[model samples]
Target: MNFLYLLVVLLPIAFGVGWWASRRAVAQRSGVQVSELSSDYFRGLNYLLNEEQDKAIEVFLRLAEYNHDTVETHLALGNLFRRRGEVDRAIRVHQHLVSRSGLSDAMKTIALLELGEDYVRAGLLDRAESLFSDLVAMKAHAPSALRHLIAIYQHERDWHKAIEHARRLEAMTGEDQAPTIAQFYCELADRSRQHGARAEAREYLQRAFACQPACVRAFMLTGQLEAEDGHHAASVDAYEAAIEADSAFLPGILPPLLASYARSHQMDRAEKFLRSLLDRYHGVSPVLALTRLYRQRDGERAAIDFLTAQLRQRPSVRGLMALIDATMDKVEGEAHENFLILRDLTTKLLEGQAMYRCSRCGFGAKAHHWQCPSCKSWSTIRPIHGVASE
Candidate 1:
């Protein structure tokens, strides 16, 4: 179905190119050349439809060589080469176009942009950066060049440059870029925090908040910085704010938030918060956290009762595992062995299951990430909500 659809889409473009080639031949008063060019064009289209890309490329390359003034033909050939992962061939085609003396300024800039993309595909980042930078400076295709520059900076982990170009893109396009800009700030903050530059990290966090007042990552980082300083109360405040900013991050936020509550001797507050979450959030993390709190503060009986009620409300494999763990000690011999088997089965069921997934791309991961590894989109990987997950 897809192959047929591709053929249908390409047929019109093929006819258009053939018509253009025929008209050009007519203008040159070459009757035989017109038939020859149309014949070759259809042959190339036939090869393309049959998935013989190498032969198609050869035919198209011949057509492009025969008509030096066919700018669109060369561009199409370069794009086809790039799509086929023949970056070297794509570069050569675009470079030939760029080096042509009679090429218009607009065509030259487009060719340069295509060459820059070819460099990116070939892992020639320095060359790509230089080409894109020149395009941005020339302001010929500034927005597209800025976007490519931002992508390159991100790949290179140059957060400052990424932020700068993103801002430039926003100014040129009149679009809201604060959310993306905040993520860039968060990246810088994380780097500073890893290097133990606490003050610098804080500064970046502030900038992130300035860009996006309710940035969830910035709040999480603030919680981490406060926790590192042994300011448990402050950490609790920041973490609670993070949850409020984005409840989808509960699995990642709740563990550290619970620790901060314990360190600050705020079990009552933790219980209240977890209870509130049970109403608003449907995930099992809060239930498990509350059960643990009850087990520690109240008794095993209270914890079991609470867990049983919650399990009846929301069925969960993890909740069942916790319930089994609580009651396993009461059983003996054959029953104890059965419980052990059940626990092992539950553990295996949970094992290797992706706990988080990207909202943008549906990329699954066992662990959470601020940016999705597949899509490279920030804050899109959220905890998976289900019976087996949070």
Candidate 2:
């Protein structure tokens, strides 16, 4: 069990044992020793209840020194130290417990797990990696050890090892790791693309699609690859496929898709696709993009008319900025100057606003992240449909 869970199971037992021992000591000795032990016990409990973990750890440490058999207390104390960000102290406590000759295999494994966590928190990832690898080989806490190893590989950007361990974890636990494995492939693709390894990147993207056929990131990357090779038609097709896979990534796919449409002389097709988005998406990006399209094809009046009508349905600061820019050119002196001031205010209003939010963790970001930076959940961040955002 994890240390938090161990605390839940062991805390009451520790208190019960302490109370019983105090009662027995009262029968044998003068009330002095019993009272002192009782006072220390209650003080430690009070510290824990008050969230004064440092003082609680000190009290528990002293108690563990005096009571040689209090392994549970030491475990709880070490866990508290780790949770409190005192990794060195936690490592010391767990390392001591791990070295004790009387510890059972079960307890030793648990202590080793906690010590591995301490090493991870201390940024001694190599040490933690070695310890967890040993645990996995022993098949004693294999799932937990494999999970830590996967996390280490992810941190190290070792996608091949990460994929191997993740598959092992899935085989052991019967948990689906397909989506995560697809993301690892995507990461590999991105790294390959960055280093100008087109063939390797394409191979990785193919693997990603094989793992998850509807992988939006894989489609987007495919579109990017096609675009980089000046294959606008293929890029447009890939971008459209990406949208079909996941419309939630509309904001992310739109810019490249629009550019590809322009490069391929497909404005009519673009209009139809964006018009379709107007029905499906609540965000104002497509609306703003369509307004610009109308301005370029028809005239300022048509664009203004379209934006004004859309603004009635979905009011947006960005739409307002667009409308002001379109209107400002026709006006002069006071009207144009006032419009400039209003545009500045609207721009400032949107300056620090988050355009995206993580559905899982409620973390707001100015840009989209495929994995939530806060919760590390995949495909959770989406465009925030609001007046100041998308």
Candidate 3:
């Protein structure tokens, strides 16, 4: 019945109303005033429980006007307004709270924070940036302010400011920001590389690796930079390092790494690396890669045998398709036609399959993303390992 929403959003307001009523009963000599305020509070709570937010806002605003010290109630109302996507009303409530002459510094800071968030939700980044920057400078709610500032910088694609504020947040909170900082550097590197700034891109990648030694994206960018300069051997090394950093990224790494191996005539290294992965990584990617490698180096019979052995262990639709493709030529007539049908069925089985998913939000995607599109988190979307996926 959506009572959960009432508990999360209106519970605090209800408690605050009860507390205010009790304080009034103690301080006021008039029982009539106490009964009126209590009635108003209950009426607002009833509206909230019924999911009539507009009527609830009206009753709560009246209560705020009646009791000057109901700061918590006002804050809760502003938050509810923002949650309901009524940003203008949220801004007004917070602005009124912030402008009150006798408001405490702490309460004012809280209201300002809310106002800044409302500004962000309304796409007034400049106002949000100014307010949050002022909060940081005043050392009031500095950590939260810094985080909001970083988010603003990220939205603006200002990596330098994002990194600066991330470091500041790290210093303030004593939590490691190296991994996220590395991602910011990687973003800068990707931009530089796309603009034909190879040296600048390389430098940024070095900084990314310096922050997080096992950053897979940094290793991938390193491999791309080296490969562009015709340094296939170096590119191969970087791509292999990427896999070692995170074996879950094998599907993304193996294609480019294999190309580098072939360009540098490092088939022997490719075979050795892929074979080594078979024990540590349980995904079908390494097995499929090794099967193709075997097919190229040995013969179709050897490839078929290897794929057949691996399919029993992994049992993947992709592996089955590869096996059918490899062995289709070896059969003729009815057998070949049947194999073609099997291959078509297997292909259909894999159609529209989500190859990657976000661990944070469970968002599924057909392609890989460095950040989760749903959660907006870095490095959370990973390849899904299953019978029909990587």
> Considering every candidate listed, which one attains the maximal lDDT?
1
RMSD of 3: 3.0
Model 2 residue runs over 4 Å out of place are 1-15, 18-39
Error of 2 at 79 (Å): 1.5
Candidate 1 C-alpha lDDT tens digits along 172-286: 9998889999999999999999999999999999999999999998999999999999999999999999999989988889999999999999999999999999999998999
List model 3 lDDT by residue over 25-128, tens digit each: 78887667777887888788788878899899899989888888879889979988998999999999999999999999999999999999999999999999
lDDT (Cα, tens digit) per residue for candidate 2, span 344-380: 9999999999989999889999988887888777888
Superior by TM-score: candidate 1 or candidate 3:
1
Clashing pairs in 3: none
Query: What is candidate 1's CA lDDT for residue 179?
Result: 96
lDDT of each: 0.92, 0.90, 0.92
Q: What is the C-alpha RMSD of each candidate to the true structure, in Å?
A: 2.2, 4.0, 3.0
**Which segments of model 1 are wrong by more than 4 Å?**
1-15, 27-29, 46-52
Cα error of candidate 1 at position 389, Å: 1.6
Stretches of candidate 3 off by over 4 Å are 1-19, 22-29, 43-55
